[model samples]
Target: MINTSTMVAPWWQQAQLGIFVHWTPASVPGWAPPYDPAGRAHLGWTSYGEWYENSLRFPGSPVSAHHRETYGSRPYTEFGGDFADALSGWDPAEWARRFRAAGARYAVLVTKHHDGYCLWPSEVRNPHRPGWHTPRDVVGEFAEAVRAEGLRFGVYYSGGLDWTFQPRPIATAADTVAAVPRGAYPAYADAQLRELIRRYHPDILWNDIAWPAGRAAIRNLVEYYRFTVPHGVVNDRLYPYTPLWRALRLPGLRAAYNSWERRTVVSDEGFVPKKPPYYDFRTPEYSHYTGPDPFEITRGVDHSFGYNRNSGDDSFIGRDALAALLGTVRSDGGNLLLNVGPRGEDATIPPEQQRRLDWLGEAAGVGSAP
Candidate 1:
């Protein structure tokens, strides 16, 4: 729980469009189920490249099937090495330039996803899984590049789910909530966030999943808002941990998280008792509703947020649609945080995603190339 008394909206609230970069080893295989078996894939369950590790854990999920067929009985840990090697060819400067050209006011890179693979050179060790972090300083390099382009830099850390920290297979929403690590996981997230704040001082601290419910988590969130980060913003997902998700009421997790059951409500963006504020801004993923809330609608042009080699030819937005999406978001008094999952091998934005971004830049009168 951050000390909300000191919290204020960062420039991002009005700056509008921010680009979310979800590049991990998952980009290596680049596949997700495309649709949520539970329901309402559009609101939340489209595609997420960061879930590669978890996908591999399931015995029958598409990701698991794909992994077995492609990699064959190999452990998922091998992809960490592969992903690190792929980092050698990454071009941060070019990425920053293109992000600027895409009219991004801020950029959030996934410093660590549920896989427990850290992008930056973190001294924090994964006690659950040894040798799980990267030796390269991806966060520092990328942050510097983005800031140099005048775009505010942000970090997305998965405090709720870490497959390496909790390696059980999960097939349902309840199973998903049950598997989140608690013991030392919160400490790990705290240390990494402190490291990110001390080193990069990211403008946004985007957390996915609720934070571990404990003293340390509260302390860290308070310290982050009070001291380490200035002008920093947090997302709605930073909630006190609820073991077994009592907050979501047993089996209503999907419904609470924006299934058709709760249409107007944004999932997991609940207020505390009678607390007035929800967040500095609201986050509605994969939809373009003309709402009145101060919000940021994040969605991938394709079905998945990460690069999906298997996303099929029709799974992307064209230049016209991209421009229209931006227009709708802006006209609705909301920000559009578009997402791009770069190929891990070359750290390149797929041509389809980039083409639309180029058009968005031109439409916003930011770039001439489109």
Candidate 2:
């Protein structure tokens, strides 16, 4: 097990505030049902717009019904073209300015979400979905822009559950474990992550879901990352699907695991893996950690992290609520990684989301946008 305690506290711990940007092809059809933040609903009813493709696969799910009514049999993959076209008008510098004005010390962009779409034109081709990534170097431009504003840059990659590889609707905890792509995915993810480290030298390696590789492989990758980007920090979600998790696929075990997952989701303690090989900090999504360990609270300004066309002012976190949340996190000596989901059609941050950020800036004594 790699010991993060020996390493000095990195810049992230002191940064306090970071902005997480989720801009994906899913934003083209951005819509998700109202989220029950209490974690009462199943994955099929997920409120995350970024999970648009997966939710659409569930029969009779709201996303599927919405897709049929809205797009009229258009495939989800077609959104890639629309997303590419929309990128023509995106201004990375403008986004960077907004983040800086919002009092963000760092900005983490979703280079690749679970939908298997890469924001950057990666050299490591996706065998299952060729030409699926954007032609423009979205990651590079965003990184440059953020750094130019004196803010650290980071990247978020879905190391597990690439929909193109598995194509299964994850409806349960066991399914979520089983959805980790096997065979080529482990190697492909490794290569792509290494490429990102080499090309972008991101200050943070924020992976989602779980890593497909085992402990040894993950350790090697972490070592390489530390050597390449000495100041880089890794999140806790890289926990691999080990034998214990694999056993969850068993009928009886699956039921028990799902029950536990449901309980954990709503627990006041928040969700943290039993024992991971390594992680610089814990990430509690839409939840919080009660332990003294270093943690970062990550959640969108609205219920969904990706732009949701259905979300209104009621779905957003108001200024007072935002202030309270920040105060609580700060009191616990943790950082807050607030998220922004720009529209896929024009890559513009929605006015509702911008309003919250502007409020945050004013509260931080940073002048709000005029």
Say which candidate scores most in lDDT: 2
Model 1, 83-162: lDDT tens digits are 89888888899999999987888899999887888898788777877777778899999999999999999898887788
Which segments of model 2 are wrong by more than 4 Å?
1-8, 37-39, 243-247, 265-275
TM-score for candidate 1: 0.85
| lDDT (Cα atoms) of all candidates against the true structure | 0.72, 0.87
Give the Cα error of residue 69 in candidate 2, in Å.
Answer: 0.6
Single out the weakest 10-residue window by summed lDDT for candidate 2: 266-275
TM-scores for all predictions = 0.85, 0.95
Candidate 2 is scored at a TM of 0.95
CA RMSD of each candidate after superposition: 4.3, 1.9
